[model samples]
Target: MGALSVDELVGRDEWDSVVRQHRRPFVVYKFAATLDGRIAAEDGTSQWITSAESRAEVHLLRAGCDATVVGSGTQQADNPNLTVRGNDDPRLDLAIVHNPDRQPLRVVIDSNAKTPADANVCNDAAPTLVVVAEGADASHLNGVVDVLKVKRADRGLDLPAVLTGLHARGVRAVFLEGGPTLAGSFIAQGLVDRVVNYVAPALLGSGKSGLGDAGIRSMSGILRLELVDVARSGADVRLVARTVRSR
Candidate 1:
């Protein structure tokens, strides 16, 4: 089989435009983890787990999407500015910016309005949307940032509703950025259409896992993925896989 170009590594058959016309926005849960499936150290220091090349590829992945989302925990910890800012690292294949002018919407799934007004995500780099519960008090953030209210679920805000809200705002694709617990919620709900994982060569013996409680108790009910693309980015291996729709 011939090798696929880096830009062709997304885990999808249909173009995002086609998929967006269907249900909610297409969701891709993406994370970089150690060889042992640890996304962060015990101290929660997770910067630069993968190589520079891998980090650079992530920019391209975000650019292809319409929004980049993260849960409250991730927002409180990382305070990311989810714009599709190009990386400083030179692309191994060729140094190119996929959409230099494109800035995907930054979305925060802050069910309780936990996002601080001064958080980096609230900056003017990109438009920010904070998803809170229907009755949650987001008045404090009213003028600070845009807010969307969704029905609450047992664990958090209804993820399906969040997607629906995003779709209404013209977001066709979402780059589900993470901090394990949120990723697990998406996986458990079967809301994620694709999984993009960057595995570093190193290992973290014990730390936060790449996924939290995903509602998997037995092997029989485990979710399976069909590998769509595999590539090497610097010293890390990037795997792009889509959830198998059929059991």
Candidate 2:
């Protein structure tokens, strides 16, 4: 769509990010894990799991989506800025995807509104939304970032409702940067459409698994994926696959 038409001639009256048609945004989740499927060490150290090249590749993916989501655990643990980063580093790929300013909305799933006011995700680089339970204490986050109150689940905010809300707000795509437990919840509910797993060569015998329990009680409940593409990103292997929707 870029090479032929729709170049700088394209302009938006409002924030309508529909790249494709659907009831809700198309979700593509990504994670980097060890050879043994660990996401972090027992001490919660997860820096530099993938090489610089592998990490750089993710910027392109973020630029394609309307929203980039992470759970509160990730925000607290990583303090990710979550932008495409080309605005910070011109050498990055965000400048190549579209307008460098056309970045994804940084979303944090903080059921209790745990996000701090000075969190890096709340920076001015991009818009941010903190999804919390119906009556969460998001008052503390008011002037800093947008707060979204959704129905509370047994353990967290309602996952499906969060997507429905974003869909209403003109978000047609979502990039889920998971923190294992949140990713597991999305998978258990069959919300994730694609999975981009970055596997490093090293191994951690125990720590946080790349994914948590996906509500699998037996083998029949297992979720399978069809591998679409595989490539070497520096020393790591990038696996891109689509979920084989059973239902």
Candidate 3:
């Protein structure tokens, strides 16, 4: 074969199977951290953890997904637009010209509806969906973006139900780009199917970890992952792994 296409590399068949089996979108968690596993500095500064090339790769991942998700904490911290960039293919140009909604949907998990109306994620560049807890006051976001109310879990919003709702809306693959707390909850709940991490050479001696409270009580409780791909992007190393099923 000349080279595996993006769909082949992303295992579209496997993703479709997952969607059919679970009635939910196939979830992929993506993040970048320091060599010491810190996602941010002691003061919570996390800009430029990896090189520009690594950041660009993240956009490519977003482009391949049906939706991109982030938690309220990430929205408060990064205020990212969560739109795909760095793709200039003529095919994509034609697609965009034909269909204005070619961009992946931006989903924000905000239990309290705390996302600001002016946040970058709330921009009109792409459609945004804010998942808030039931009975929460989303009046602030009424005109800013669309909102979805879901049952609340102990950690936050009910993830499985949220995924099911997304699936109903035709989201096949979801790219998760939330903070550690949100990521940890997904991992602890066994909802993550794949993880893509970019490890930078720099070290943050004291800072926030890349994963928080995963409920791993002992060595045996640790979630195991099967390393699938490893590559270098500029000075950062990208590691792609799939969650190994429990026996």
Candidate 4:
């Protein structure tokens, strides 16, 4: 009827309605892609996929969240600052899944120390939380970022525990802007709360798809969504969908 609240569009109410309410943390996923589901061009270049206005909208989404996360692939590809800018109160804490000591609160999910020392996060003036699993190669990076080594029996970053710990640090909401692998990890874990897709009117058939083989076995395994709204942004289509779990 009236202009919807951000929460209404993202299904916060439905999420709260679930029997197992996610008290640990809430997640918001944001990504841009072409109409044919391509996230990057054939050469792995993706800049200005969404409009400046849509980028501002994403910053607005970041403004409302406590932490913004990205993966090492995205870190290497986009090298995003991973923080909100150009808003009334822009800025969100950053969380990168790489070696924190080698990088910045870069969280290394692997049990080995392979991150380089000159990663951008390490050079940036931002607080970081480097997460590492137990028995990881202890070869340290020369104090570029803070290090917090966590033990994971599964030999992978314990994402649920990571979220719980983040919530403990007052991160009520977390925004994930990772590439498809990390996004797929969250989706497979059923940890994604909602998704915002900015669809551009173009095609890149042989590049990376927005959601690669992250683990969706079939069409049924894809995360179901309820289209809440769609609006045109120049020649682009900004589609907002709420995950079924939230509904």
Candidate 5:
């Protein structure tokens, strides 16, 4: 048989399980970090953490998801145009076969509506959804991108509500590419079903960690993950794991 399809690698059954349990899209937190688990340098410089091959793998993951999500901090820092750009491989032309014309919905959890109107995510490359606090002023993004106002949580916008809103819009799977705090919030809330981590060989002794405080105070409170797959792309090692929910 040929290489497993993206759906198989991502596990559609797992996605369905999450939807059945929470009535929302399955959430996968994806990120690249240094060997020391730092996502960025001390001054917030995070350009090109992983190899090009690893980045191409990320695009494949994005192509398989119904929606791509990020936090406002990530938006401000990277200003990425959250769209899938499949690699140029004539032999493996899977990305082109999956929704060539349409791009996955780009969702940003911006509690304060601080996303710049001219941000790349606000461009027409893909449909953008901005989730803000109920009373936050979203007028700035009114014409630039779609906006959803929800109750505020400790981390920022209510994450579960945001997922529900995405589900209402027909999203079944969400690829969460974060800037740390947002990823931590999803894990702390037990909303993450899977994690795709790309670990580079380099190390940043003291910098921005890949995850922020996730409310884990005791050893028993530690979150667990069941390793599903592991592969190497250049100097980076990609580890795909599913959250082992506690009983």
Candidate 6:
């Protein structure tokens, strides 16, 4: 309801307490896109969509998180390091979800193995965690990464199980830096606790929609948000909204 200053916008006290209020695993969805709601350029290029100040605020948000999550598509296409480079604090742990066994420690929902060893998330800075259906490669992926095999009825990881596993790891709060499909999954499951939008002024035509093909049709299905604060940094606008429903 009220406007926030630059310091209040990026400070730890504001988010840390709110995030810690969750006794179970809570997910924070952070995204930045064009005014048209496109997260990437026509060529799948999405580098620095928000202003430097907004991006810096993202890092601060990461610091308040226990872990950061993203889909494997983001890792393969964007090759993001996924590290928390804070301006005033430390970094958060990173997690990835992948199916078909393309990445290790990847939260996969399918029975098939498809992730590649050379994937960017298979690096040292942020180890991978594969969440796959039962009967996936149970062979020890120990030194490289950790694997979490779940019992999935359909071709997807059980959402509650995934959250339970994450909670076991002391990840009370999770930040989702997504490519659309993953975002859609979380939203559809009604698992998102907060949404942070760093709106940029630019417009890019025919690029990837934030969550491509994830049907979020009706307005009623949209997640309810309580406007916590709004701030402007240069040409960008930071809108921080917390989900009001409980899971």
Q: How would you encode candidate 2's per-residue C-alpha lDDT over 1-247 as one tens digit per residue?
A: 1110111111121113223333666777899999999989999999878887767767766766789999999999989989885445454454443443566888999998889999998978788989999877888898998888999876577988999889887887788997888998988888887788889999989889998877889988778888767778778888877788721
| Candidate 1 lDDT tens digits, 167-222 | 88898788898868888888888888778999999988988899998889999989
Question: After aligning candidate 4 to the native by TM-score, how far in Å is the CA of 137 from where it should be?
Answer: 4.3
For candidate 3, write residues 125-226 as lDDT tens digits.
788999999999999889889999999998898999899889989999999998899999998888898889899999989999999887789998889898
lDDT (CA) per prediction: 0.80, 0.77, 0.83, 0.63, 0.83, 0.63
Position 196, candidate 6: lDDT: 80
What RMSD, rounded to one decimal, does every model reach? 3.4, 5.5, 2.7, 5.6, 2.4, 6.5
lDDT (Cα, 0-100) at 141 in candidate 6: 49
Candidate 5 lDDT tens digits, 1-247 = 2222458666777678778777988888888999999889999898889998788778777877889999998898888889887647443455444443478899899999999899999887778899999999889887789999999987787888998899999999999998688988988898888888999999889889988888899998999899988878767888888888921
* Candidate 5: stretches off by over 4 Å: 1-5, 90-101
TM-score-best of 3 and 4: 3
Model 4 / residue 108 / CA error / Å: 7.4
Per-residue alpha-carbon lDDT of model 4 for 83-197, expressed as tens digits?
4455242232233223222222233333344445666555564555555566665456546655556656342467887777776666666777777877887777787877888
RMSD versus native structure for model 4: 5.6
For candidate 4, what is the lDDT? Answer: 0.63
Q: Residue 45 deviation, candidate 1, in Å? A: 0.9
- TM-score: the better of candidates 4 and 5: 5
C-alpha TM-score for every candidate = 0.89, 0.86, 0.92, 0.78, 0.92, 0.76
**Residue 225 error, candidate 1, Å:** 0.9
